[model samples]
Target: MKNKQEIPAVIVADAKVFDYLKEKVGERKTRTEAYSDLLDKSLAGFISPFLRKQDYDLQPCQCHVTISDLATEWHWHRATVRSFLETLEAFGQLKRTRLAKSIVITMPVQSGQSSATFVIQRQPDFAIQLQEVLSDWIVGKTTSADVGNLCGQVVHQAMTGMTGYESRHCPDSHIDTASAHAGKQEEEIRKTALGCIAHAALQRVLWKSRFDDSSPLIEFFRHDLDEEWVSFIEASKELAELILDTEACETTFDTDDDKERLKSLRKPFLSLLARTQEPAD
Candidate 1:
């Protein structure tokens, strides 16, 4: 185990880190002041090397912090402090447990956290795309009330695009009603399957934004996402590239083989989509 003195400067000091801290602090504080304050507050009595080596669930980290103390120290709202702490826990940057009266936080080994590599992309076009897509699906052009309605509309469009099928009526030539019913069922299945494909495409677009260790998306959606979501976000960039490749395929018509290959590739995304669904009554 490396002592604090032996810890590399690369991990301990960076000018960019102070900029990030300043942004999170969200007040009039300058970068220098933020850095100085952060050092004063967080570094003293910080978790030691021995604490990191212990089994956290059995022998928790020695650092115990209250949310109110953090809120006051950081000049942030109590709710914001709570959310930030939860995000840290989700990222494996810290461990949090609830006691009978208060919350206990345990700082994790920072060296382990340095292993993640982040790729940042510049997304100048996504804001326009999101607005356009949302505009197309939502009606009644303007109202504060309608802003609340947009969430449902976006979800509804995704679900509709995923499950919509053109229902076919029985033809006179097909005298068998049972055969007609089976045909309808098959059509429904096809529609539902195609909807899943569309939903995957939507996801590829939605989360394909720029992300780094310092992204605010981590803070905002932190409650719903975890460190594992980072991998999914990274994979979506590759998925977007694959989508471009498929679109540019020279074949005018897709063969059964191509269809099966696409289905196999999308299986994981479809499974994730299933997990996101609300349980039915």
Candidate 2:
């Protein structure tokens, strides 16, 4: 086993990198949570070269990483850490092989596409939880879109509670234009905050399809954040560009009348779920 102590001390590639993570992850995550997430990304980058050598035509972009080493470095439970890795694999973010006690992780991307990076929100940590939920929903072999629809419902359920205020105000139509026509500032503020959170969650789900870092919706990571959190942020131009280039797909599912508003997000939810089942080639 590699010496856990020898795992290079966490170093900031760019002090400003953290700011981007914070922005992407949202205020829903604590600085500690955000820092830990950034550290993982940093460690993954450090481990990438080693992983590249293990890449195979059948299992490309592979690397050997021990659960103990990760748990020790991250000060997390071994089981929890293992669960997270398994969840990543389950989500098709990576593939894992157990070589004795050591874990070999493979990125299922093409050699030329190795530059691709994936982001997922670690705080709400919904990926793994949602993966498990979908497992039950996926009774038999199903399409990625089907699983995605189920995942979308889960997201819709999560954001549903936040919309209570909006429902009380509009009752019939929660659309911003409807509320805007009525012109109520309190309702608008509530709706905007809720919208931001819902949108962030939806965006995170969509990004998951592309296999990049995914974060929950909260607030945009500000470039001018305190130096303490500076290492968390990364430039968002690429992510922003990706979002612009990608179009959202909508799906429909049966729901109570109250949840009719969530139908529009079916495409995004399905998109996230579908990405996980994408061809491994």
Candidate 3:
């Protein structure tokens, strides 16, 4: 078996010259270009508009999308869309939040902290998080958009020393009705930066005890975070620390009861968890 430290790192290429060359060469997309394009679309949420009903599960063009919608938009087979997403997800280059009918693609853009990798692992999906607030639209359907910094670069690097920031160029968002909206973007991230940092502390505590059989904290990492799960995590901090924390949880009546308590916590969120179909390892 390989040492845990032997894990390989994933590269996040800047969206620049490489794609320009690809476009000049041909219209057909390689898997590399497809992932690039998908990322680009999500980043370009300024124009994507919130055309659907006000379901808390949906984010505005501020970078939320359905798989069927994206496949049609890209003119690719749905299988093709799923394949690219699954591949990217496994590499940790992108994140996919699977909903009842469509998958919410996060992480085409990551910038200042409001959130981790987009807000927690090197997973940078906060691009939309900023836009949602900047544009004042119902953003990223994250159940706990309040926990915007749950998985952020500040949180990730502080927790694991990984460079979780994804610095892509922002689209033409003119809140001042001008060119770039950099000022406002930075402003809002500051507001949420503290929350992101606090969550990082929580993440660090969770990571230290991930292997403890009696602890279920690792469930956050094992499963893709949905809106419901996020809210559940934030809803009761002291309760979570007592029940989910490794040291705290181990002080149970017994292992069986410990598991039962863990199950109780999971039951509320399993609706989305059970329905989720992440790309296989």
Residue pairs with backbone atoms closer than 3 Å in model 1 (clashes) = 162-195
User: Relative to the unseen true structure, what is the C-alpha lDDT of residue 172 in candidate 2, on a scale of 0 to 100?
Assistant: 59
Decide which is better by lDDT, 1 or 3: 3
Q: What's the candidate order when arranged by decreasing TM-score?
A: 3, 2, 1
> What is the lDDT ranking, best to worst?
3, 2, 1
Q: List candidate 2 segments past 4 Å from native.
A: 1-19, 22-60, 109-111, 114-281
Worst 10 residues of 1 by lDDT: 115-124
Error of 3 at 20 (Å): 2.8
lDDT string, candidate 2, 1-281, tens digits:
95544311112133245455554343234434534453444335434333446643333345566677666655666665665565455443456767655666664332333111211211123333454444433433545575556555545543443244345545455476534533343343234333433433453455445543222211223322233243223213223323444333121223444133233333443454446544221
RMSD in Å for all candidates: 26.6, 23.7, 14.7
Against the true structure, candidate 1 reaches a TM-score of 0.26
Model 3's alpha-carbon lDDT is: 0.44
Candidate scoring better on TM-score of 1 and 3: 3
Clashes of each: 1, 26, 21
Model 3 lDDT per residue over 39-129, tens place:
5766665223443553644343235666666666666667767866764554334667755665566653554443322322223333323
